[model samples]
Target: MNPGLPFLPQNEPSGHEDEGEPTQTPNLEVKLAGEPALTVAEYVSLRTEILKLIELQAQLLSLALLSLGALLGVAVQQRNSNIAFVYPVLALILSFSWLNHAHAIHRCARYLVEAVEPASGGALGWERFVRQHPLPFGMLGYWGVRSVFMGSSLVATLVGWSLPHPTLLTVIAGVASSLLTLAAFVLFLVWRESSPKQLKVEGHPGSTA
Candidate 1:
């Protein structure tokens, strides 16, 4: 008989062996004790992946913008005014896609910091990193740079050269650009409200689990 488990049965009928031994119930305290370690492991892995994704998206954003600029240079060299209109339209599409990717990364990091990190045990550095960066679309941010350059290019395309009366395509492009700019602004507000409020690190490095 186990000395510590006084509640466990000391004996069972001989025929009970064929019926399969009574199921041994797990100790709730022991199970609960093991859970935090598992949670921490999961949080660490997820946080690392989120950080990697953020870096990857940043690189992609830079590459996309650079490609867009190069496209403009080509259009200019070829004296293709139509290409100017097409470039901004394409630029806005690419920028919006990039914006979505950035927001996803932000939400993932927010979940890790706000929920997982605290529950598993504190690792505040990740939270700090996430908060400091802010949303890419916020003022003077990466998306801001992209928006300013692309938007300016778009305005220049519409006004720099005079064409005959506004064509259907020109009017459509103008309306689309305006709508996209407003949508991007709304998205920025949503992210800002939902994102972490402070950039300050919350715990000692040596105290992390």
Candidate 2:
């Protein structure tokens, strides 16, 4: 059992797992204090902005990973053991990138919870959403699917670099560049999908300036 969380009551009189467990429920409320009161369209606008931030953050993560891997490979060729040393630097980069990614998702989720429901409820509810939604929180609907494309490009880059030759750096660059482009494309698509819709909001829900 994890030491940090609250100790659960014995689930059963016989000390069984299900004897006295506390049942958990999903409570969907995502409101924030600083955020403007948003309509559905405004909420979607924030979603679009957050999508761009997420896509950029993901690209940064993949590139940072690929960077560490390639630097190690290059250092290997140069007989430089310092390649191992720089891994910590790579880790720092990764941590920052991931933190940014998480922040972006949190921003989007905050709006969804707060915009849809005025009250954000309690800590448990926030924790529940965080766990269930994980990284990208695909509830952004179609935009979340873009992760697949990004993941694919990153994998391709890594595979190309895994070859047993120095020339494979080209492939690695290709992979990183491709993922970067995909990230750009995701942002473009999000803005494209959202901006026009924002314009045509004659009596529509969530329309915004």
Clashes of each: 0, 9
**Which runs in model 1 stand beyond 4 Å of their true positions?**
2-33, 123-125, 128-139, 142-209
Estimate TM-scores for all models: 0.57, 0.38
**What are the per-residue Cα lDDT tens digits for candidate 1 across 80-137?**
5444455555555555665666667766766776677778555445665555555554
Compare the candidates by lDDT and give the number of the best one: 1
Pairs that clash in candidate 1: none
Error of 1 at 84 (Å): 1.2
- Tell me the whole-model lDDT of each prediction, alpha carbons only: 0.57, 0.47
State the weakest 10-residue window (summed lDDT) of model 1: 195-204
- Give the clash count for model 1: 0
Q: Residue 3 of candidate 1: its Cα lDDT?
A: 54
The runs of at least 3 residues in candidate 2 whose Cα sits more than 4 Å from the true structure, single-residue gaps closed, are 1-38, 117-209
